[model samples]
Target: MNNWKPRVSMGIPVYNGENFLREVLDSLLAQTFEDFELIISDNASSDRTEEICRSYAAKDKRIRYHRQEINRGPAWNFNRVFELAQGEYFKWVAHDDIYAPEFLAKCVEVLDRDDSVVLCYAKTKFIDSEGKILKEYDYQIATDSPQPAERYRSLVLVNHRKHAAVEIFGLIRSDALKKTPLLGYYARGDSVLLVRLSLLGRFYEIPEYLFFNRDHSQRSVKEKQVQIARGRTIVAKFLGMGPLPPTEWFDPSRKGKIDFPEWRLFYEYFISVKSFPLAVKEQISCYLYLGYWLFKNWMKLVRDLLIAAEQLVRASYKAQKIIEISLEKRF
Candidate 1:
C-alpha cells in the first residue's frame, strides 16, 4: 500500500515448490519498487505451496493468490498468470529463482524511458537449490558483436535455446506479449516467444546483475528425454518439407554437444522458407547442423531408402520361389 505508481505485474507460478517458497516471497517483498502487484498461481501443488502463498497473501494487500483445481504444467500455469495480469509491463518469476532488491526498479526505469524496447533482461547468476551462488550468465547473448538483427539471425537460425537466456524473469511489454499466443508449442516455448518479440522490435539489454536462475536436477529437460527429443519434430513441423536447396547448413556452437537433433531441426525449420536467397543461406546453415545431428546416422535417410528397396527385391524373389514349388507339386 505504498504511495507509488504501479508499473509492473509480476507473475509467479508454483508447483510443489515448498522448500524455497518462503525465500522467494521474501525477496519479492523486499523489492525497492513497492508499486508492483504480485500474482501467484498455484498449480494444485500437493506440497505446502498453498499454505505459503496464502500466508503471504494475508500480509500483502497487493498480492493476489489463486489455486487451480488441476495441475496444468508450467506453460499453462505461466500463461494463466499472464492472462490475469493488469500492469503495463509483465515479468514472470519461477518458483525457485530469486531476484535482486532493485531488479524490478531498474527494469521499470528503462521501460518507462523507452517506448521502443519490447523486452528487457539483465545478467543472471546461477544458483543451487539452497540459494548458493554458482556462476554468472553474463557472456551468453549479451556481447554478440553484430547488430541486433544479425545477432538475432545467427542465434535463431542455429536454434540457440540453451545458449539464450531463460525467459523466466525478463520484463516484457504486456501489449507486445499479448500479441503472440503463449504455450502452444511443445519445447522451447520461451525461445519461440523471444524470437517472435524480436521480430517486432529491439530488445533492451541491462548489463547489470539483477536476477538469479536456479539449476536443479528435477528440471523438465532432465526428466523427459523423449519429450526433449521430440523438440526436433516440432522444429521440423515448422520448417516444412521442400526441395531445391543443397547449400544451406547449420553451424551449431561447438562448445556444447547437447541436443544435436534440435540443432538440425533448427536448420530444417529455416530451410522451409520460400524465399530463394534465405532458402540458400538457411540450407547451408542446416547442413552444418546436419553434420552434427546426423553424424553417425549421416546416411540414415539414404540407408532407410536402400533397406526398403532390398526388402522389395527379397519379397519378389520369395514369391517366385513359392510359384515354382507349387508348379512342381501340381505336375
Candidate 2:
C-alpha cells in the first residue's frame, strides 16, 4: 500500500462474488475520473473471487485488495473498507452493481462545488441478472433540505417502494462519515446509516441516471433473511459476542433491554440531534416527527411480527418432518 492519496476512494466489499466481480471492476477501471483508488475487501470467499481480484490487482496499481482470513458478515466487510480508506471522499460499491463511466466524475464535481452537501448520488436504473434494464427507480428522499430537521424527516419518515437504500452508494465526505457510526449489523442498517448522515448535512442528487443497481435472487438482503430463518443471529455473529441488548444494536457502548430496530433507529436519531448544534425548538420538532413516524408504522410493525411468526412455524414444521423421515429410515 503506497502513501499516495487519492481524491476519491471507492470501496467494494465482496464474498463469493466472482460471477460479476470482473464486470464491476471493469466498470470502475473505465471511469472518466482517474484520481481514485479502488479498495476491494474479500471476506474469505471460497470461490474464484480471490484469483480474480489478485489478477486485477497485479495489473492495476490503483487497485488494493485485502482478504480476510475468516468470513465475516456483510456489515463488517462493508465497514472494513471505509476503515481502510485514505481519501477526501468515499463511496461504497457493491460487487454485482455496475456504474456508468461518468458516475464518479459527475458525483465528484458536485461535491467539489458544494461545501454543505455531505453526500452526492445519481439517479438509479434497476437491472436484471442478465444486464437487461428493468425500470428506473422513482422514490426520492428529501436530503437536500437546508434544515437538518427536514433532512432527518425525509430520510426516516419516507416509505420507498423500491431501492430505498440505494443512496448508501453515494460519494460522501470522509470527515462527515467518520463522525457517524458506519453501519449496524441489523437488517435495515443501511437505512439507519443514511438517517444519521442526513442529520449531519445536505445530500445532492445528480440528475442523470448513472447508477445501475442489480436485482437478483442472491442479493444480500434475501440471503440475510434466509440466514435469520436458519436460527443464526447476524448481529451477534458480526460483533463476535453473545446476544446483546437492543441499545447496543446501534450504540455499541450501551447495554439496555431489547427493542425493535425501528425504535432503535429513532433512539439513534435523537442521539444525533442531541450531539449536533440544533436549536431547542428544532430538537423538539425532530422528536415530535419521530413520534409521528412511530404512529404511522405501528400497523406495519404488527404485520411484520405476524409474518415472522408464520415463517418460524413453517421452519419448525420442515425440521420436524426431516427428523421423522430419518427415524422411519432407521427403523
Candidate 3:
C-alpha cells in the first residue's frame, strides 16, 4: 500500500447527512483504488455527520475531514472541496450517493489513458433511501464528442433532459477546474461550469452503471427550479446570435460589444450587417423557441392554477361542513 500512487482525489461534500454518511464513506474505503485520498468537507452539519467523519478520519489516514465554521451552502462547499483538492484528477461524490467498487479505478484509467478527454461520466443507477435496487438510468448519456458548436447546440436543446450534474462523474483535470471556479450562480452554474470544462477539452462516457443516485422527497426543489431558469438563460444567450459581452459587464479592454465565440454568439451578427436570410433564421429559431416555451409554461401555469382552485374549493367545503355539524349539535 505504501507503493500505491494516489492519482485521484475523491471529494465528498456533506451537510447533515448523518443517516447515509457512514454508508458512503464505507463504500469509498472499500473501493478497489486504495491509493486515493478521500477529502470529506463537512459544511457545518448540525447532526452526527461531523462525528462520523471524524471517526473515519481517525480510522483511515487517507480520509481528510474538514468542517466549515459556517454553512457555505452546497455550491460553495463543493467549490471549497475542489479548490482544496491536491490530486491530478478530482471527482465529486455526493454525501447521499454510493459508488460501485471499480468506479474510481475505471475513471482514473480513462483519464490516465486519454490526454484529450477532460471529462468522463458513466450511467447511474437510481436507488431508494434504503439502498434498494430501483432502476438503471442511462437516458443522459451523450455518445459523441461533437465540435464545440454542436456541443452547445445539443446542450441548449437537451441538457436538462440529461442526468444530475451533482453526481459529477467525470475525472476532472485539476488544472482545468481551477480556471473555472464554481461561483454560486442562481441556476445552471453546473451547466455553465460544464461549458467551461468542455471548452478545456473533450468528454468521454463510461459504458457502465458505476454510480448510485438516491431519489427521495428531501431533494431541493428550489435549487432545481433555479438550475432550470439559469439553463434557459444560458441557452438563450448562446442562441441569441450576437457576440457575447465580456464575462461580465464590469470588465473593460474589449468594452461595449466585442465579437463572441461563433459557437455561442447570438443572431445579432446578421442583423447588425443586414444579411436577410441569416438574420431571418436567427429570428425564426429564437422566436419559435420563445413562443413554444411561453405557450408551454402558460399551459402548465393554467393547470397548476386549476389544481389550486380545486384544492381551495375542497378545503372550503370541508370547513363549511364542520361549521354546519357544530350548529346542528347545538340546536
Best by lDDT: 2
- Tens-digit per-residue lDDT, 30-139, candidate 1: 99988889999998999899988998999998889999998766667888889888898998888788888998888888888877677777888899887788887754
Pairs of residues at least 3 apart in sequence or in different chains that clash in candidate 3:
240-266, 240-267, 241-265, 241-266, 241-267, 242-266, 243-260
Candidate 3, residue 318: the lDDT equals 86
Clash totals for all candidate models: 15, 0, 7
TM-score of model 1 (CA atoms): 0.67
> Distance from true position, residue 263, model 3, in Å?
19
**Model 2 Cα shift for residue 310 (angstroms):** 12
Using TM-score as the measure, which candidate wins? 2
In model 1, the worst 10-residue window by lDDT is: 243-252
- Estimate every model's Cα lDDT from 0 to 1: 0.64, 0.80, 0.63
TM-score of each: 0.67, 0.81, 0.66
Candidate 1 residue runs with Cα over 4 Å from true position: 1-5, 142-148, 158-164, 221-331
Which candidate do you rate higher for TM-score, 1 or 3?
1
Question: Candidates ranked by TM-score, best first?
Answer: 2, 1, 3
